[model samples]
Target: MPKVSSVIVPYAVYLRVYEPLAAFPEPERTHWARYARRPDLPSYQDELRRSLAGLLPTPPVAAPVQESGDAFVTEVDGVLCVCPWRTRLRGWLALAELDEELPRPVLEAALPEVVRLQAAQDHERWLESNPDARPWIRMAVWQVPLHWFVLVSDEERAYEKGTGEVAPVLRYRTPMVQARRRVARSLRTLKDSMDEGPLVEGLLDVGRWLEEFHPRSLVELDYGGLVHVLPAGDLEDDHSARDVAEGIEALRTGDGAAAGEAYARLVERWRSVRDRRSAN
Candidate 1:
């Protein structure tokens, strides 16, 4: 069997409502400021590097190398980072030294079937197994030449205590909200850049795949790390997979005007949220 490695690369867009922090009394303000100034936040490239570093056999010594397409293949330290770009997000598939490198042809032939087989149960199993982890949010998974990659968000949820009451704590960071905005933006961009081609068809196929899930089921883009770069917005807004499904359909039908309008709405909303953050 091929060696499989599972790693969590931190999402690049960390959306938090920090306005309340400004209202804090003296010492509290000082304490929060310390955290705000921390330098450890991961950039998109940094997240890829970190994920590869953890799964690779040796530490990478050089920057990642881009390939003919949006994919980037690099053999650094002792492992290979097969990073592929999907829409705005980047999927990271780190291959260890010992794992046989599946040829591109083989991967292309096998991945679609593998994705279909796994998609049905992966999220359900993950949630059931990790009871203490954040609740299952949206995720995008993808398969590269040698490995399968996933960009997921299990956002914080209310915890029930022994008294059978849920905690009232508000979850400030909404990864799912940002995820929806990102998908919307990606679909619009994809529609704008391509005509009726394989790429466009592939994305439409993904949209159909999402439609296969139950209404309440969480949908994943399944493009490995490539989905991570999609635009994220304020956590207060609610977004669902259906929104993405509609966007895909619009794009497929050459409804560029409608797609553009949706993208404009997302951009305007997120911009307002950012402006508020700046004001705070």
Candidate 2:
């Protein structure tokens, strides 16, 4: 095998399941995010590195050849990405030299048991800083070449006692919201008869996002959730909501499946928003 020297990576760590922040993109995050944890290319950089440190009576993981605050330039073959309200996230850990697609379940075999053992150390540190009723560490492992993402959330005793939307993570995501609107609009035009391709493509995007997502982000995944489309709901929802209302204006004007589907999507899109608000 060829000797590997260096690579680049990015990563995230989330704590709560379906936490609202899980929906927003990282760059737009509010300034308040910094108080919780350390972030680097493959998140929990120290934990991951300490776990994988090559050899010593008690050695450090291979030092990053170079690193910045969010991305670490190293030779490790793994990466992590941060996800919202703390449920899901993704990051990159570049693996040098060994280039074939990684096998499934390689993480358990590759990372040492001590990494798992060190969990409490960070937990104590996090608790000391914020002292939330509960503290958790969710690690998302991603191996890009293999198309893999695995989640690990080490939650604390206090949180496990609770259930049902305890807290919400505020999100400010422009790109994801734009993509949601685009897809919803295309879906609204399904009856145009001009072509089915665009609408079909929109459905495809919806399916992909739905499948990979947890239930929380799905709530306000859009602009206050889905397109308004007139009498159905508020006008501020977005263009697609207005479009849906217009489409219905041209509908056979009945609550048949097509109308129902459109209306249902409007509701579904806004569900994340509604649910969170209800919880609050």
Candidate 3:
């Protein structure tokens, strides 16, 4: 097995608050219109820099907006930008160089403050008027630098007045979990194919990497904006990690035939799933 070093997993917390333009009073609406303009304008970037200053320990590295309105705009490092639109204030903060153990408390504490600064008064007033709005805050965590696969999890929370806190009320999807299921299924398929090659070796490599993490490690995917566009079924996960480990172990014991068989099983399983889905 290859040595696993201390890897710095890049993580990001995406925060978004949605409110209609009509909900805002006249003066505030005008103010936002100027704030949420095209990124090419020097004034727009400056405004974001000023608003977010000192909000996070690491300042945003200025970069061009990646997309149009309502899209996530960010820099290469820890810097974050709120891509404001007529209806929403959406952005993400990249928490660079996080350890495998994700610090949930630190994230929880900083989120509200960031929202308070970025959303300004709009978030509060929206809640005041809508009162019944479900899950006022939408947050997602992204585990970065995913080369071959990705995993995504969504958490919904409600704000409490007395404590000024956001409590998680629901967590429905975990892409990583689903990926595990697929990997199990793929292993079953590979059982029949039995051809040894680079693909099998690559799967073994992934398994080795996953084995390096602590058992309780939280594996997340960085879906970013694709959460809005991609179908839940289309995303991938880290499910094959264990099986690859098993195959590698067989190879280490000098059982070339056994290693080849393991690879075959994975290949067949994945192919079957793809064919079945395509037929559907």
Q: What C-alpha lDDT values do all the predictions have?
A: 0.34, 0.32, 0.36
How does candidate 3 score on lDDT?
Answer: 0.36
Of 1 and 2, the candidate ahead on TM-score is 1
Tens digit of lDDT per residue, candidate 3, span 1-280? Answer: 1112222211222222223333346785565455445554322223333324435554331112231233223321232232243213233222222222347576445444444344445545555875543321233333212222312222311212222232111112222334444444444444345574544454454444444333323333333432222233333332333345456556556677877776676565455444644554
Worst 10 residues of 2 by lDDT: 143-152
The C-alpha TM-scores of every prediction are 0.25, 0.23, 0.24
Steric clash pairs (candidate 3): 60-79, 151-221, 189-269, 190-264, 190-265, 190-266, 190-269, 191-265, 194-264
lDDT of 2 by residue, 160-223 (tens): 1112432211112222333345445545545453355534654654435433543333212211
TM-score of candidate 2 to 2 decimals? 0.23
Candidate 3 Cα errors over 4 Å, as ranges:
1-239
Error of 3 at 79 (Å): 19
RMSD in order of candidates? 19.0, 19.4, 19.9
Better of 1 and 3 by TM-score: 1
Clashes of each: 14, 36, 9
Evaluate residue 163 in candidate 1 and report its C-alpha lDDT on the 0 to 100 scale.
Answer: 24
